[model samples]
Target chain A: MHPAGSLIIFTVLSGLGFGLLAFLGAGVVLPLGWEAFVWFAAGYALAGGGLLASVFHLGHPERALLAFTQWRTSWLSREAVLAVAALGMMAPYAAGSVFFAQPLPVFGAIAAVLCLATVIATSMIYATIRAVPRWHHWTTPAVFLAAALAGGALLAGQLRLAGGLFAVLAVALALHWQAGDRRWRDAESTPGSATGLGRIGRVRLFERPHTGANYITREMVHVVGRRHSAKLRLIALVGGAVLPAMLLALMPASLLAAGAALGLHLVGILAARWLFFAEAEHVVGLYYGRAAA
Target chain B: MTDLPETTDKKLGLVIDLDICVGCHACVTSCKEWNSQGYGAPLADADAYGPAPEGAFLNRVHSFEVTSEDGPPQLVHFPRSCLHCEDAPCVTVCPTGASHKRAEDGIVLVEESMCIGCGLCAWACPYGAREMDPAEQVMKKCTLCVDRIYNENLPPEDREPSCVRACPTGARHFGDLGDASSAVSQLVAARDGFDLMPEQGTKPVNKYLPPRERDRATAAPALEPVGEAGGFLGWLDRALSRL
Candidate 1:
């Protein structure tokens, strides 16, 4: 699993953006006039910017609209549709509150749910990949949802709620990592099974198919960042979850404290997200003789 | 449209014999040669002659050593490509309807015109079968040489996959595996050909024939010591010694 830069940005930014939108729609923070405008603008900018970043990774960005058609079977397609729906639904509610000072509670509630659903859809894009045993677990969605909720609470200035959610996020992250580390071996997929040569005897790669790297090796057989994973995990826990949780709990509620907490949390989450892809072992690696034992 | 059909009309695929493959990469070369010009996009190479060359290939041959208690280690040349599964995760995972299994022949293909090249299909495949063409920036895979297999323009004898036609040892066999009476199905029955990664539950159409057991006693018979030379040779030897 290659920890693609665009995808990392997309997942982290959009998760935070949608989390904020969810809180706003749920009436967690009620701001009027220009203040409402600022909040809604930040939400749209982060969410929209993240969505835009995703397109950069596509080979044919012009045909991305076609991606919306296969929602019935494709999580990526579902994500595209859900993102659009969430943003579209939130638009009117945001406009009414910001410009007209009319807080449409019912519309806001619906938009909030949609926002959360979009995050779920985004998480499912990775979660549904059975080829990557690490991500195929139920804990993938759990980790993602917890992060979004906690990050959203932080952005919405709900320090009390954010502190609780961060604790939950820490637990989810730990659970996901613990389970994910054992997923490949638990699946019982070895090189012998991958090549259907187990019955004969022990199978070991005698020769690789090519001297140079191919797309599959580049995309799925990544192992370069794995050496630093333990250190990165510590960073993710401290910066993304533990410190943020502690800061919100002990410190007085202030704009500066909240901003500093959000910055640290984002840095931690970025590192965690990087690990999410870098540490994941795709079953395809077995064929290339690159999978972890 | 990404949803798979209930079933395909014909389960057309390949059955490769590991024992016969010499790891020559002839099928690999032929597949690339035909597919580069035949299909939607030419298989592109990045820095082909540069320090670190990379390219998109539809098929590749990997060699592995199989060691058993009964015999010494033996090398098996394994050729890998798309299995074109009955339950292809690649097709269902396509965000665009570009990746789909044909209901008529069960050949999984990418409709390149509709492809957004998001690469989720490649990620879903456990076999590492599909490759993203670097230059074209679209997913490339073994189409089973669909252009040649069904092409009326080609000679009737040439109407098969390029790899099958190019195999020097006749190790690659292409036919309908769904039909019990088909030659490939019969061969599979006789040789105990098995699917790769059955637990993935992709229900692959393709099969692989395991390498036959090798004769451990490969040493040549010891030459008998000639106690005395044959009549002509003995006479010649004695006369030479007298001289």
Candidate 2:
């Protein structure tokens, strides 16, 4: 879990983009004239940008097309396929809703469902990493889904919807943080369990396998100190959720408040996502003397 | 293709004896030499001749001291590589059909030509078994010497993994693990060999033999003075002087 910049951007941006599309597709927001096109265009842009950013970190970016073909098993593949389907369906729905001013009820409904599924699939890509106990819990997906919905509501300029989702999102974030912090405190895997030497006794590393960091060490052994984690957690809470919620409450009084809330929320999520990657303890880290087991 | 087989015909794997491994890296070097020139992409190194050198290696040996309160501390050398699990998550997580487990032999391998090198397979592997080669933009790992083990051109005696063939102490053993009557299987049963991470439940084919304990009575202890007869000039002191 290197906390790669590209991947962070991909996850957060795609989540918001897809979330916005879900709202629009379901006819929750009925924008007139050019506003409808703007909403759809912005959603597509963010979603597509996140996807392109994801490819940036791949060793073989040219072969990404083949990724869609493995949806039968790979969650990453399923996400890609669903994202494309969501975008495809959104195209016609947007045309009908924006150009003809007649929302295709059936198409909109299907597109909305696809958008939500795409976001869930994307969340599952990280949530299913069993080696990282913090991310493996059901809380991971709960936080991700809530973040998408809340972010989507805010960006779509639906104050009441955003207000409601902000409360739900707050609860999800608190739960995710509590569970993740507990996991960090009570790491069940030790070098003994990781190496299967627990039957002998408590296994502690006497020597590391290498002098310098190797691929496993660099990729998986992310050690965020307790104090630093506390600070970041505070920032994620105040900025990602609290500040946005407060700003949205005042949005009806001032148009500038919406933009401020959206901006603060995005930055807050960046910090949160960074913590997400930084805090995950991959089991391989046990071999490096970086994780419990 | 991503799904594992319900049953494989023969489980080909290795059994590493922790007792005999001397921390010598002969297996690691031999693996690098053989695999760099054969069957797959070369195990490339970055800044190999520079101040800080980093590279990809298939087999690695680690030495650690395991201490017990009642006895003297023991230094154990652990040789690590792929275990070729029966239900390898590495194979299941590959987005392309590149990573697969052989239904015939239960050996997991990556088809480099089809690999997208997204590194998901590496993340899925709990053993830290997968290696990504930056040169080919592909994932490389211990193939169990897939090329030589089945090569008809090679001599029958040479038909083994490079690590097993090059082990100086013969600590690494290879055989058909699927057969209950196989020599390796019998060795495992006799030695009480165990899987590295049974809790992960990947059902690794490879097993490790725990080190045998030294008998306290047979172990050498510091020589005590032979009473008032000869405090500094004891038989043990004389014997040491002779050496």
Which candidate number has the best TM-score?
Answer: 1
List per-model TM-scores for chain B.
0.89, 0.88
Candidate 2 lDDT over A1-293, as tens digits, reads 78887888889999999999999988888775589989998999998889988886788888888888778888988998999999999888899878888878788889999999998998888887777778877888888898899999888878767867876777888899889878756766667766666656556676776676667777777664544888888788778888788777755745687778788788888888998888787887777665462
Model 2 spans with C-alpha error above 4 angstroms: A184-187, A224-227, A250-253, A291-293, B217-243
**Candidate 1: global Cα-lDDT?**
0.91
Name the regions of candidate 1 deviating beyond 4 angstroms.
B218-243
In model 2, what are the clashing residue pairs, if there are any? A189-A293, A190-A292, A190-A293
Best by DockQ: 1
Write one digit per residue (lDDT tens) for candidate 1, span A85-155.
88998888898899889989888899999999999998898898888999999999998899999999998
Candidate 1 CAPRI grade: medium
Question: What are the lDDT figures for the candidates, one per model?
Answer: 0.91, 0.83
Best by lDDT: 1
For candidate 2, the per-residue lDDT at A153 reads 88
Per-residue lDDT for B1-243 in model 1, tens only?
A: 788999888999999999899999999999989988988899889998899988999999999888888887989999999999999999998999999999999999999988988889999998999999889888889998899988999999899999999999999999999899999999999999999989888999999999998878777989998697868989999999999
Chain A TM-score for model 1, please? 0.98
Q: Which CAPRI quality tier does the interface of model 2 achieve?
A: medium
